[model samples]
Target: MFKIKSLVFIFLVFYSTINYAQFTDVINSNRPGQSMAAFSVGKTVIQAELGINRIIEKDKDVDYKAAIWNSDLALRYGVFFEQFELIANLEYQNEKFTAPGVDIHEGALKKVLIGAKYLIYDPEKNYEKKPNLYSWKANHKFNWRQFIPAVGIYGGVNANLAKNKFLRGSDIPRDEDFTLKGMILTQNQFGRYTFLTNIILDKFPSQRNSIDYVLTMTRGFNDRVSGFLEIQGFNNEFYKDHFLRTGAAYLVRQNIQVDASVASNFQASPNIVFAGVGASWRFDANYNEVMLRVPKEEKNDGKSKKEKKDKEKKDKEKKKRKDAVENTEFK
Candidate 1:
């Protein structure tokens, strides 16, 4: 039985010197968390990740409490090449606010983003980490090279539509209809553990100018299950907070996965908590495997042309003599 590992982030097959592997035997998904993976789906493959969350927030300073429900969807397609992916994300939220003798409800599209990610460097490229057949200790020993992670760059445009109350908080400005977002993604996998990190700059050149980071660690328990813990930090002119999330994912099939996670911020002024469930599916019916070919080169052993000719002549004469002997025997 083949176990599906934590395919959350970068896992690549390097062929020749210019290849980064795309796709896998099973679907690779970045879900139950907010970070993106460094590897793209296979060329011509399309994938969808969808989730819904229940969020609760309490603000002592503002003297308000809220309950929110949100649904998010991401569509990813491999385009142009295996190292590149185009993605679109959409989120919708419904909220209810309660205070001293006050009740309010709101609903809107919280997010609309279109992005592209490209893998710039893959540590596993042109390198294979072979297991030591004789020494188990050598196989288990820590290798310093795992510190080198695969790197990717992402850039996107966020469309802040009207009536999106979530994006237009009291502290945030709504002057910008569109903002540019960029992120740096990195991932490392060794043994059963995989580590991923993302550094993001959102709403760039805008008043909010948010800076965010996510760190995640995932471990594979068996062929069908994987668990992950993640931490995210957000900083901007208006607010700052840290959040922790933990979750497990189950592989339902080679092309489908289901996951659930709980998250909470480590703060008091305005505390927040959320729980979510998600699923990812991939369609790869049009994908064709790409392989590298190396041209065969003729070998030269420094044999003289006259020596080759003499050998050929002797072989022909020997064949002739054998034929002559056969003819005489027949006669």
Candidate 2:
């Protein structure tokens, strides 16, 4: 136990020592989407987000009612040497009855997730500044969503860590069993309007025949505010459940964001609802310097970053050979 604690401490120290190189997690996110930003959070960046929500449900007879306080947390680390990210998730749930004389009251750690994402493909493409030439309606302004989109693909897994006490009758988290997920992400900009989309597929080991799909769309109002709408459910099976959610988020500069959302299980009994508020903060040893100095799309003349990197490598090699020849003559 002591060794485990010590190792965690060391890992955090290393995480914080990094720099803030990319955007924080998307706003108004109920679940982690597969949309990878075109750029990696530079090696020195560390990001975290926290969500808190209240759930209300009543028995059909209206005698028993339960209110649960659920908290969701996620932390991400950037390994800038490669287009890779490491993330961890922790969830805590507090349950109680608002009504008087109810014996059921419990709150404990419910779930944990540890995963990694590698950017396999990123078309570092940018849109030229253009006007919203709306021809259909008289006053419809154009936006970034009208342009061709840049795509990013990522894959990861969420490990299940449910305490035996937290798993009993009528209580199970959606991420209960070990699940593997793959995501396709894309987005385009219309002026200050950014539309990000994600298509996700989740597979459960215990239920090999079952797969879940989560499709999400995020609209950005500006650099500081954004909103989202989503539809998530099961696909191709005997059982199908569909859910809808909407929310908004406000950014505190480039490193901090606060958001809120409300949702519900449409077919649930007694008409229960879910509402939540959360915030995410990104920090690194060098947030101020990088956030202010470097733009995410560096040199967007249709030349990808990898091409520029190869050019630099060749230039250095040529310089090294020239220097070696001069030294040989001098010797």
lDDT of 2 by residue, 1-331 (tens): 0000000000010111123323333322223222334344545567777777777765454455677777877777777543567767677777775445546677766666566655544333222333335654434544333566645565666555544333323433333456776666664544434455556565444343245544456655655666766555555333455556677777665555677777665554344567877776667665333332223343465457798899889999999999999999999
What is candidate 2's local distance difference test score?
0.52
Cα deviation of 228 in candidate 2 (Å)?
2.3
Give all candidates' CA lDDT scores: 0.76, 0.52
Candidate 1 regions with alpha-carbon error over 4 angstroms: 1-20, 128-141, 162-164, 167-171, 292-331
RMSD (Cα, Å) for all candidates, in order, is 7.7, 11.9
Q: Which ranges of candidate 2 are over 4 A from the true structure?
A: 1-40, 58-65, 97-103, 125-149, 164-179, 208-210, 234-239, 287-331
Q: After superposition, how far is residue 153 of candidate 2 from its true place, in Å?
A: 4.2
Per-model TM values vs. the true structure = 0.80, 0.60
Question: What TM-score does model 2 achieve against the real structure?
Answer: 0.60
How high is the lDDT of residue 218 in model 2?
Answer: 63
By summed lDDT, the worst window of 10 consecutive residues in model 1 runs over: 1-10
